[model samples]
Structure formats: structure tokens, C-alpha cells
Target: MSRKIREGLLMLISIVLLATGGTILYRQLLPSSAVKADGAKSGGQLSVRHAPEPKADVQGRFPAQSVERYAFSQEGKDLFSLLVARYQDSIGLPQSAVLFPKDAQEIASSPTGLRHDIWQSAADIIARKAPENALFLSWWDDGQRIHYLSGKEAWLRKPSDKTFVGPVWKALQDSLPVASDEERARLAQMARWLTMDSEKALSEIAAHFGASRPVYLLVNNDLLLHLAEFTAYGGTSLSLDSKNIPAGNDLHGDIALVKRWAFEAGDGNYLAQKEGNYYRVWSTPDAKAKNTLLVRLLPFIDSLKKLPKGVSLVYQSHWGGFLSVYKIDNQPIH
Candidate 1:
């Protein structure tokens, strides 16, 4: 097989899930209906399976060894660390990737999680832009990173009423008991808040914070191999489209390849971070999906030429996995 073809196939197979709490993430093979056999297999049928479960019950669920602290930066005291969960492989097995600083550069992008450097850099952005009293409304994970790295206050610790089980396991998930804390429940609504209509989402945010203090909306890159927590909690679905773009004799070929992927996905709203010659494209063909906050918030994937009204970009990291902070404008997106 050609190198390009081989890499595409591996990406198709290597896709995995998020390891937060009871989150079970796995990328299902794209349906055969859209298969393009020119140089592809598995019939081009890539669908996202979002299965987020129980909250991060560190003491109760995961073993001590499963969770470890990694000192990813020099900015912190001595060994300022972030708790990482290493649970399950591509097949829902118990095995996980127990990595060290040495592996940061190697496995630090999409299809994988952030590396030590990326974490520190993202934290640095928060430290610089975010004011001391600014309120952060993002996923719990980002909140923790913000609190740890920037020393800014974020509602990241109070275990949310087990991040709402994804669409696939709604019945079973609803059965799982949830804590009745209002703030926790509000936090749990992050899924709907993120994936819903932009206007309504903004309105909700306004209502929640009510100008009591400064609020910054934080989002990260969507080019992850695992089932993104945002899509899972929001029950959003999209096909996982993998491609092997030949970089030709230069970088121009690579750039063109990414552009083509964007065109195919109804604009640049559904792109995944490219991995060498391989690109994991998230295909959004529907109207509802086309208007989601997840797509618009992503830097390169946004369909707009520039950020629209009411949405201002505060910081965009060179690496998508790193966080992006946005300040809400009083006006609504037009």
C-alpha cells in the first residue's frame, strides 16, 4: 500500500475515546454508504459515538495508579502538576497510555490529548489575558487547568452531576444518580449550552452571569482522536472522515489538501487538526450542526472570515488543543 494510504487506514483504526470520569469514547467506522474506494477502505463511513458517563469520581472509580500527576511546566512552584487519566485503549479495554514528558512532543495533538508544554502555554495565556475576578464558563477540565496554571478562579472542582451521559446511553445514563446541586446541574448543562443556537446560548450565558462579574467563554481544539466530550454531552453526531493528502513536493500541496477537506465539509466548519499526511475530518452536513458553537469557536474550522459580532477572540493558541478564550459582547451574533 502507498504510505499515504497506509496512514489513512491507521488513522481510521487508531481513533479512540476520552478518558474523563466514566467517559467511554470510540470512533465508529464510517458507514459504507459514503465509502469512496479510490484509495480508501471501510467505505468512508465515519461516525462520532459520544458516550460520556459518571463524573470524575477519582476515589471511587479509578485505581490510584490510573491517575497520575505530570509536571508539565516550570512556571509552577516545584512540580506543579495536572491530573491525567489513563484508562482504556481503542477497544474499550482497561489498558491506557502511561506517558512521560519525553512523549509530549510525539503524542500532543488531535487523536491524542495535550502535552506538558501545551498545557503550560495555555495556562500562560489565561494568566495574561484573564483578570483576577473574571469568571470562566468552560468544561471542568479546562477550569482545573485555568485554576492551576493562571491562579484565576474557575468553577472547575465541584464534581458536576456526572456529565450528562451522551445520546447513545441516555436511558442508562438518566438512571445513574445525579447530585442535586444547582451549580453542578448548571455545569452539567454545558453540553446543551455549547451545541445549541448561538443566540439562545448567549442569552443563557447573560442570564447566568447577569453582568455580576466578567465572564469569559473558553473552548479548545476539536481535533482529538477520542470522542470529544463536547459532542458527547451535547449528543452531537458527525462522520469521522479520514484522508491522506499528499503534501506533493512542498507545503503547498498540504495546504491545498486541507482546503479541499473544508470544501467537502460545507466550508471550514468541520475540520480536524491534520496529522502529517493524514487528516481526520469531521463532516457536518446538517443545518443544526452547521450552526453549533463548537464549530464556530474552533479557530481554523470556523466558516466566518472573521469573528462575528458579540463574539470576540481573546486568545487563540498556536496549538488547537490549547485553550481559546473569548469575551462575550453585549450584542448577539448577527
Candidate 2:
């Protein structure tokens, strides 16, 4: 080979060797964080925190009484117990179930066995109603502290509470006024959003709730009663004469009806729990479902302050009833 040709070949080999060494050095020296930081510094890439996988059953199953005991004051406990019994299984009842009697005085006179059965039935109903992706369970520690057995560390306090309160917390007090001003504001917005055209509502709901989860417009009125007429089924028999079971009647009735109508009748038009993206139009004269609905709505509606103007949120009612419409830009019930 000529000297010039040999020199050219040597230069080419040197370039290749240099390129290979630089590539290997870059891979070895650059940590993931360093790369991410450098990319961010360039204003082109983003860094995200990767959450760890959740552990199973971390808090385990807490007893209903434990939650009641921890979350409530003595008076609250008494009132809550009565409230639970009055509504029976909570979700599976006509609005009229609340009117069987008024006030805690009436519940105190009721039988213990009846109350126990109602409490158990209500827990079962809640478990059934809770979504697989969402947090489910009725009871908490007596101090109103919530601990879960799965995913991350077990004990969780409500995000809004500043104290980081936990460990033998008191049960939430009873006769707690429903719907704070902030809640009312959001609900008013929600109501107005519902008042929009059905097509609008449907589209908004599909977008916000995703295609998977069911939506609900819960209320305390005849509407839920009608829906509950459809949910009652599969509860343990209350007594030899089914009418005597005040404890399990509310939920059982729903299980029974759902079994009969939702499946047996095979009515596609009638909404049932079996379907995804269904609506729950819960209403009850006693207002347990209504109260529960309000409680659930609190944190969710708080998030609405961040929503863009004219962007309405819509929920689908599982049980067809009064809460179906959105209350748009209207006065909230004080």
C-alpha cells in the first residue's frame, strides 16, 4: 500500500476506536437521575416520580365496631348506631325506609338483634357497592382514623386534616351538619352541570369518569326508594315471615329485587349494578344514602375549584331517580 493510503486507513481506524470508547464511557458515567437532570436543564425532557407497587392487605379487615368506636364520641356512637339501623343496609331501600320513625329515641327502643343484623347487612351492602379500584369498607377505628391493609404504608388520615391524627382516633361525631359551604358551592356547580343537555352531560360524564366506573346522583327522597325497589335481593332471610326483619330488610330487599328484575326480567332499559358505567340515583326519606353520598362528594367536589370554566362534570345514576339532573349555576340549598 502507498504511504498516503496507509495514513488514510490509520486515521479511519483511530476515528472508529475513539467513537466506540466515547459511547461506552457515556453509558457507564451517566446515571438515570443525571440524564434526567441534564435533559430537564435543556428544557426538553421531563422527570416523573415512579410510585412503588402496592402491597396486599396492609391494614387488613377492620371490624365495623372498631371504626365506630374510634371515630365517634359516645353520643355520636349512639346516634350513628341508630342511624345505621334506621337505614338498614344503607343503600338498598326506598326513601320511605327513613320515615319508619324519626329521631334516635325511636332507634333505642328497637331490638339489639335487629340492630346487629342491620349493621351487618349495611356493611355487606357497602362492600358490594364499593368499586374494586376504590377504597371500600364501612368501619374504621373509633377515632375516625382510617387504616388500610394494602398498598404503601397502611394507615391513612384524611388529606384535609392537618394533625396527621391516627392510632385509636375517635369516631366522627354524629348529627354532623351535611354539606359545608365549599361542598354546597361544588354541588351547585355539579347540579348546574347536570342541567345541561343530555348529550352534553353524557359526553362530560364519559370523559371525566372514564368508560369504566359507574356514576351516581344520590339524593334523599322518593327517587332512591324507587331504585331500591330494584336492588333488594340475596340477603339472609330476616325471619320466617320476611316482613319482620327490620335489620336486613333494606339491603336484602334490593338484592332480592335485583335478582328478580335485573336478571330474571332481563330488562336492558332498567339499570342494574351488574353493568359498568351505570348510575346510582340514591334517595331515601331518612337520608342515610343521601348523607353517605354527600360525604363521598366532599373531597371529590373540592377538586372542582381547579376545573376550567364551562367544563361540566356529570355522573351517571345507577338507580334511575331524582338526582339525575345537574344543578347548573343555581342556588344551593343552604
Which number leads on lDDT? 1
Report the CA-based lDDT of candidate 1 relative to the real structure.
0.45
Q: Which candidate number maximizes TM-score?
A: 1
lDDT of each: 0.45, 0.24
lDDT tens per residue, model 2, 122-235:
334333443444321111110011112111111111211211122111112231223345544433434333233334544564465554533333222221111211122111
Q: For candidate 1, give the lDDT of residue 146.
A: 56
- Candidate 2 — worst ten consecutive residues by lDDT sum? 236-245
